[model samples]
Target: MPTHLWQKSSYSAEANACLYVSTPDDATIRLRESDQPDTILTTTPTTLHALIRSAKAGQLDHLSTA
Candidate 1:
């Protein structure tokens, strides 16, 4: 993967709660965390989009221990 292709989430820069992502191909969404960059979660754009929406809506709040 090209180094330039991976982008960190905005909050990653300001906090250790890092999230990184890449789109290696049109059909895939790749996710990583700074604490474990070698591991990745691959998904479809549609699913990722829905996840983002749910997260932003606080629907995922129950999963958080914070």
Candidate 2:
């Protein structure tokens, strides 16, 4: 099996927990947190785009109690 080179945004703090993303295949998107590397979430590009759009629009803010 080939290794996926996970990448995180340059804007994220180097010493803090960050979200890492990887593409194991053309149709798959993988996400994992720095603090919890064993847990991964997978989604498609379309779904990921929608998530970003919703996040940017603050639609998910209500779900967070913070």
Candidate 3:
């Protein structure tokens, strides 16, 4: 896979609790932790949108240990 531009989450800082995203030419978004560039997870746009919605609705709070 070609390397796409990865952007760190706005809420991320130098301390390392950050997620990075890259939107490749296929329109699927790639997600990875800033601290682990070798590992990546890919999701389609539709699924990504749904995840964002669920997160905004607080449905994913239980998944967060922090």
Candidate 4:
């Protein structure tokens, strides 16, 4: 397994608890929460792209209580 060089989202709040993303290779995307470093999720680039697009378009706002 390649090392997951995670980077925090620029849109993340100025707190430590935020979402992180990593692409160890061209075909793989990894996501994890800063507070739960060990619990990482693997996804495809297409899926990740869709997720980001949806989030930016507020398509997932209903999932959040805030």
Candidate 5:
């Protein structure tokens, strides 16, 4: 089996769901649920930054509720 290597978030709870992120040398950031690190989704830095900004602006909550 392949290794499920991922970095843990500082705010992660022991029994609750969390996320893990891996930034590769090629500048791609990969993300996955901490409980399922083997399955990953990759995104560019610019896209990730935009998503973070949108999240901070509360735009994501509207999208999530839609």
Candidate 6:
């Protein structure tokens, strides 16, 4: 019901592609990329944290086909 203000990561300032995230409420998180503003991904804080941890630990590298 409230407006969400998206914030770009400071690390992305010098990159052509950027990641933006917003929290419209305590239980929800929204994310979008600079190239695709209309398409958003929604998830919970816990899930997002787990995802980051996994990615950082290289647990997700094998899933990438590239």
Residues 1-66 of candidate 4: C-alpha lDDT, one tens digit per residue: 657678998978988889999988899988898889889999999998899899999999999986
User: What would the per-residue lDDT of candidate 3 be over residues 7-52, giving only the tens digit for each residue?
Assistant: 9888788787588989886778899997788899999999999998
lDDT of 1 by residue, 1-66 (tens): 456378888776766759988988899989999888888899999999999899999999999988
Candidates ranked, most accurate by lDDT first: 6, 2, 4, 3, 1, 5
Identify the runs in model 6 with alpha carbons over 4 angstroms from their true place.
1-3
Clashes of each: 0, 0, 0, 0, 0, 0
lDDT of each: 0.87, 0.89, 0.88, 0.88, 0.78, 0.90
TM-scores for all predictions: 0.76, 0.85, 0.75, 0.73, 0.73, 0.85
Q: How far is candidate 1 from the true structure (C-alpha RMSD, Å)?
A: 2.4
RMSD of each: 2.4, 1.6, 2.0, 2.0, 2.6, 1.8
**Which model is ahead, 1 or 3, in terms of TM-score?**
1
Q: Against the true structure, candidate 5 has what lDDT? A: 0.78
Positional deviation of residue 34's Cα in model 3 after best superposition, in angstroms: 1.3
**What clash pairs does model 2 have?**
none
lDDT value, candidate 6, whole model: 0.90
* Model 5 misplaced regions, further than 4 Å: 1-5
| Residue runs of model 1 more than 4 Å from their true location after superposition | 1-4
Candidate 3, superposed: residue stretches over 4 Å from native: 64-66
Q: List the residue pairs that clash in candidate 6.
A: none
Better of 1 and 4 by TM-score: 1
Give the alpha carbon lDDT tens digit for every residue of 1-66 in model 2.
357889996766888688899998889999888999888898999999999999999999999977
